[model samples]
Target chain A: MSLESDIPSWVQALAGGGLIGLSAALLMGLEGRILGISGFVRSVLEADPKLKGPSTAFLLGLVLVGILAQFYFVDTLTNTQPRSYMITILAGLLVGYGTAMGNGCTSGHGVCGLSRFSYRSLIATLSFMAAGMLTVTLHRVLMGGM
Target chain B: MKQQITHFIIGILFGIGLLLSGMTQPGKVIGFLDIFGNWVPDLAFVMIGAILINSIAHKFLMRRGRPLFGTGFNLPSKKDLDRPLIQGSILFGIGWGLAGFCPGPAIVSIGGLQTPAILFGIGLVIGASVFIVKKNQVK
Candidate 1:
């Protein structure tokens, strides 16, 4: 379907897609670990000394690129509608709790899990999508089509 | 030293992928989630492409005895369909639709150190702490 949009570019999408896959595979190949963003965040916050250094380094790289990209690759990191701080915070809390409970997020399950042929990931992905879709419906209904 | 550098580069690669794929953009993510609305299926392309590439790479990688820096591959071996998995996923989906910022893009946004994302990151830490204290098993 790949409909055209101001934001969606098929070429870039595919290229980005490949890079993500390669990045995860590269990490797995080299570090012997699944490159789950949620896991990285957790490690940064709580891992032992050995894991801490690499996790911090990864986050540092992310921020470094994020800052430079805003100046150059400006369109890459656009924020939307600026929801109320309360709603945003609540959303953040929900994401944190959910990811922790689920044992992974998009990158962990969606990318790495599915790639490895994990049936758990398939179900988790489906459940998350279904839940996400339902949340959207609830959001629209409750927030007056926000 | 080598491990640190690899992770840094991988982070950058991942950040760029997220940005280019529009996963870093809240509007685009929300658009993808709202299946009843004018859903944008662009992310579908991103996921498919990644999965195909990774699937191939996975076969080769798993064939190896050990990783370059570790004693073994740290892949999750769990196969159970438990309540936590289901409930947690639903909770995550709700949060994702609410803000369109997951752990990946949310952490990437830390570069700018903006208020909303920073707050979200803080919340993320707190959530992790609570789960660690209570559940003790994270994927």
Candidate 2:
């Protein structure tokens, strides 16, 4: 299928977008920290002395909520496709290490930081997008489109 | 306690939001990244919508001296840019493009029992640990 044909309807996008924004806002207003997924992962994985409790709770919430949501949105949402296990591992390494050192990810840098007009976020967003675009192109050329 | 409960509620809301928005789907993410090809711009709207709301809300939220649950709003105050930031972002971007699974969506995928998600999540955990180990060694 052509890429254009793959996008979801605008209504779903807007509603989902609004919910994402609201969720980030609620976290900020309530917890006073950026909802960057990488940061959360780092905190939990590293056993960050300061972030242990909140991070655990947040991660738990993310997964628990996801399980419940899948049942509700089964008709609209599809499960993640399996790729070559090697590809998944390598890519996961890149994403995880990058975000761990960089201090954010799509949620943190793309949404939260960009909204704050942080210069770092701007650079990060561009970098990730460009990298993502280039990687996709390379994958298309090399892996024959996974 | 109360804070943990709130976090749990937010997590559920965030997951539902991601699923409803199709952020949990790899094809959609690939479509968004495939800007040069048969581009799909719908996910852009999700990003824009979230940013717009957050941008507006942050301004107002900043006025409050203390957070609802804590003593203060612990915003990232650093203004300096560094190598780690750029390098990290590039790697993240490449991985994101390759896998279409950032930590958030990857975790969701894992929650849903996707095999790729499981592999990627393991990578994420190990990769992060490796970075920590390497960094500690350097220090």
Tell me what fraction of the real C-alpha contacts between chains A and B each candidate also makes.
0.75, 0.72
lDDT by residue for model 2 (B1-139), tens: 7777777778777777787677878777877898766567878888977888888888888977666887778778877888998999999999998888888877876777667888999999888888888999999
Give the winner by DockQ.
Answer: 1
Off by over 4 Å in 1: A1-8, B136-139
Q: Once model 1 is optimally superposed onto the true structure by TM-score, how far is the C-alpha of residue A115 displaced, in angstroms?
A: 0.2
State the lDDT at A78 in candidate 1.
72
* DockQ of every predicted complex: 0.67, 0.66
Cα RMSD to the true fold for all candidates: 3.4, 3.3
User: Model 1: DockQ against the native?
Assistant: 0.67
Q: lDDT tens string, model 1, A9-43?
A: 76677777888898899999899988888777777
**Candidate 1: Cα lDDT at B70:** 84
